[model samples]
Target: LSLHPVSVLVLKVNEVSLGIEVRGEDLAVALQAEELSLQQLGTVGLWQFLHGQCSDISFQESSALKTDHIRPAVGLRFEAGPGAAVHSPLATQNGFLHFLLRGCDLELFTSVLNGLGPFLEDEEIPVVVPMKIELLHSRITLKDDIPPIYPTSPGPVPITLAMEHVVLKRSDDGVFHIGAPAQDRPSAEVPKSEKRQSAKEQMFLVPTEEAFGQLVKELPTLQKELRETKQALADANQEKDRLLQEIRKYNPLFE
Candidate 1:
């Protein structure tokens, strides 16, 4: 997908004695589009933020790599504020975003994102495209419940890519949730020989090029609202301080 010229949030990586830790900050990842409705953009934001961070990481063995594993094993921690969901035009509820990823291909994904930098910046990236990386033995947990890892074919069990085919929904309670993709039967589109392939074997996606554009278009409006709210809060605090000072004038302790 196309990434516009927006502020990028970077993820930080740390290699401890046990394993690798990847952490990213909140980033705007919402698309104000009519074709596909997105109630929450946390998943998308997390990917973009992490991708940006991965670019900043130093790949030297003496610096970042410490473990004996051939490929770096990664654990992802994602967090975003309620207001970060810029997709919904009228989102009043301040929801929270949290998720974790295990056994993802950090190196390959990082390389892919880095390669797409020029294209994304120029808004020339293709829409609905698939990448070469797959997350093997990876599991993602959103909020409280962890989705069950479904078995695929000969490659690996519970494989997932970035946010390609993954589906998330907002429940009746207005909470965004992630669940396992339904697999009742094989599709007609798939060949009979490949029907037994697992969910991870299939491609999944995050936000599309159109969706990214929509988000960029909506960011300015949100920023204006945020500025006005902050000004109002500052004014209120000043008024409170004035009243406190006036009260202190009548107290002997002030002398």
Candidate 2:
């Protein structure tokens, strides 16, 4: 009965340079992406691209990426200011956190959600979606039941966490938001994936009218190419059949 949409992204020292970890969780937890860079896209977006493969200039820069960088940790519960709309002139920057939750204490994680009840409450439904946390200078303690993949002491250790969510457009203004608002969703238009990418990120655009016309004009050429290919295949098959017939004729068994 507690099914919620949750997306997590992991950015580790070396194990995971960049990748998306798609998972379904009963508890809805949204972690804000920091720096809002294209690197975050590799893990959040339905369509994924490698760090350097994307058009992000930072990815292209040799010194931009570093695995040893110790990411900031955030609290289990926190507050977020109203984010600027994508189309808003006042929209400048929002420092977000990226978190990864794996092999951790589920009960403890659930307990942490206790503080987020107010923020997660949805007016349209009975379910609650937790407010996105910004883990800054805090460590997440794991349960003893889960085996430790990374080196850890007898107690808790710090880990990276990344967040993904549907981009919501404010009805009042066209600006996009990271977390869902209490307002009705239908009025918000169809939500889009809110994976932050760099300005240099590339996307496949729909063809223009002129481009479509050109493609229509080239249909005859394409059909001609197809016809020529079929003909060549037919000619090759005929040659093969003739060669086989000649071989059978020359056989002593025929004589």
Candidate 3:
């Protein structure tokens, strides 16, 4: 299948880090077309805002990797059997990370992005077809019903290559997994044995190329919606804090 280009969102939720991405030419084109439809229909102002300016569109992808620093092991112990007891030092890094994609073939995915030079030109919004990447983690232990290592701040950081494949494998809750070819794996005519064997060889993938293309087109809209929702939650929390402070001043019972 032909992988489309689109923005990807990577989330590191506890020990289950995951990268859920989208890839599909037809899908991407279809999303853009649908958004265009919404624009034409004037159902929502937002659709009109994104319509035709190439603002609501996306591209197909090759392969891209976002990384985190090498997490040092916390503690170690010796055991008599093949396995050894150990306690890992918690992994730490800046809390927020963001990445952008340009529409290009798989061949140029890495080199072009890596060599992306100084802010010379305008932030080049690309003409990708449609694609996505959702990366997640679930290593953190449960403490008080939440990830033991939740962050309160945000910043940009790189994902380490050594654990990159591991991140992909751990994406779906560290389930039984497989590796498959990107392009060839997406096709329906391809035999199942071939798909399974290729999966044995591939690092990770969801959906065939055709399916991926259709799926990919919606990533940006979904991501935008997610971000806005998160921001709203943060705002609500801030408001709650303000009200609590006011209560502490006026309410004599607690005092």
Candidate 4:
């Protein structure tokens, strides 16, 4: 039996983004439900992302969010350097598994175990499970399969909280109202339906997040990239200026 635990953020109703950490319990159920819905996604890559099936969901990157704006607040964020955690996707259900890994591929972990069934003839698929679930097959099947309506972002990495298991936390701005029944609201990346908002602005961001520490780590990377780009632009401009001066030297302004 092949199964892998994928850390994914609920980015939209159908579509979602993944990162390093995830609401493992929430995501376990959500993604199982998501994969079951799009058994077909195994074949087409990126197609589902654009259809409003998903969205990009990420963390606030700053400080404590107002308690009111927070959804599924787990209490804290994970630290860096879990890169080795991500492994080859589980081979169960064929290529269908990788689709669910899209956004949270880094946090995903795969395992092999004997598959048990009612008939006692189940195949060992090297099953995957979030660090929480011990009996992978006991979990519901079809509930995980839901057709995505878009695409999503990678999720945050797992953090071992004071309680051992990583706890969910929020960095929301505390202004927007995130609706109820958690599952009812779509993931952040679901594309806007054409019947809605001229179909351009509705489906927006893919769900993903991180805490202050993450941005702190990324800040240096962002700055370095920006500096390199700025220098490249300056060199290009200097070359253009030299060429223009040469052209002016040979051309008549009034003629």
Candidate 5:
């Protein structure tokens, strides 16, 4: 496992009132198992093993206790190697797993305050504030390795199982709503079927060896076209310079 950079801040209104804030840039986690067996302990055993593996791990970074806002993690990824093996109890094959989460931003706020005591009677009533949390522009992905069926083909190809943007907001009523962000939603003039098709296009992706080979073969041709385009632009610039010089010769005051 590797982390790029992280920071944390905590805010304390009083001894009993506090909020925690955390931020991070990038995080990568990896697991490898040659022979994993947990038949004796059941499902709880898997959690125990994972906890034991990560309990004492720590990161060195500076933190302060003076903020009231929390930021979401960026560029988070989790991967399992192909060599991993699961024993009988779990009933899972020995393939690879990859998960990615990116572009996340989160905000949460809560507090305890007094009700309208000054405007009403003299007695003050404590009111528990509602907590609000909002998440914006987050994307998640899960992929698994697909074994090759033919002997002539290359190794396995990773196929995406799930990928989509998620937007969630919890209002003061404590009801969570899921929907697309306002800016990301399709225009009002677009047809409903078109919008549905666009959404379907974003969900699935499959990469094959034939497509990879085609892309490799086209690379040289693409490079050649790029070079020709650059040469043409240079020639056009030279011609412009010559024309400017001729105009300057005709009219010296054209500075």
Candidate 6:
């Protein structure tokens, strides 16, 4: 995959504290055509929108902190690549698959920071302080395979796969759970009366009865105005056609 231009909001490194922080914004990644072997995936291409923030990266003394962990908020998306779905367990009805991630928090632990002790003698590497991360909302969509148009044309490609979104939320117990794709209770558990009331409450928004009555009263007038506008447009078109015909009679080039 080829990397596109990357832009960051802020980048800071503290030599005294032996810490580094990077806050990125509007970062993009892309894969050009024929960059990878297409024998298995067939003319694959990819574009990524990294619109999430990564903040609060610092190194601290291992003993001062409890455990070394990194959790970051993330918003990332991948687009138009069959290679992305190679490891997916789910099957797509169409030939393409789209992936979307929103509102996610990821946490992981590692000892790589502490292993850097030999590089920096004066500064102590932290073995316990967790890395903090934040990600924003993003989506990836797949388009229909249109050879010759892709990797050349600058126009937008048409999407083929249905977009599926997943949201991660931390519960009160501090464990992350899938908030979307909510489970439905058994139909037998809900009474018919309650179901009817719920349906009534879910009605779409509409004009108030008084406002609707007013509109009804002026319906004839509105219809008359619409007809007048259409007539005027027709008259203008006729006039334009007459003028063009006259020009064609005089100018052989126009004819």
User: Which pairs in model 5 have colliding backbones?
Assistant: none
* Tens digits of lDDT, candidate 2, 11-73: 322222222222232111232212221122222222323323333423211112322212211
Best model number under lDDT? 1
Number of backbone clashes in candidate 2? 12
Ranking of predictions according to TM-score: 1, 5, 2, 4, 6, 3
Q: For each candidate, give its TM-score against the true structure.
A: 0.26, 0.24, 0.21, 0.22, 0.25, 0.21
Alpha-carbon lDDT, every model: 0.36, 0.33, 0.29, 0.29, 0.33, 0.32
Residue-level lDDT tens digits of model 3 in 1-255: 123222221211122222333333111111000000001111123333345323332332222222221121111111111110111111011111111111111221222232344323567753221111222221211112112353863422323322112211111122333343234355875445334332221123224575556557877887899899999999999999888888888885653
How many residue pairs clash (N, CA or C atoms closer than 3 angstroms) in each of the candidate models, in the order given? 7, 12, 57, 76, 0, 8
Q: Which stretches of candidate 4 lie over 4 Å from their true place?
A: 1-215, 253-255
Clashes of 3: 57
- Residue-by-residue lDDT tens digits, candidate 1, 152-195: 53432433344333435443245554543444234654344234
TM-score top scorer:
1
TM-score (C-alpha, index-matched) for candidate 2: 0.24
Question: How does model 3 score by TM-score?
Answer: 0.21
Q: Quote the positional error of residue 170 for candidate 1 in Å.
A: 14
**Model 2 accuracy (lDDT, Cα):** 0.33
Model 1 residue pairs with clashes:
152-198, 163-205, 163-206, 164-204, 164-205, 165-204, 165-205
CA deviation > 4 Å runs, candidate 6: 1-205
- Per-residue lDDT, model 6, residue 59, is 32
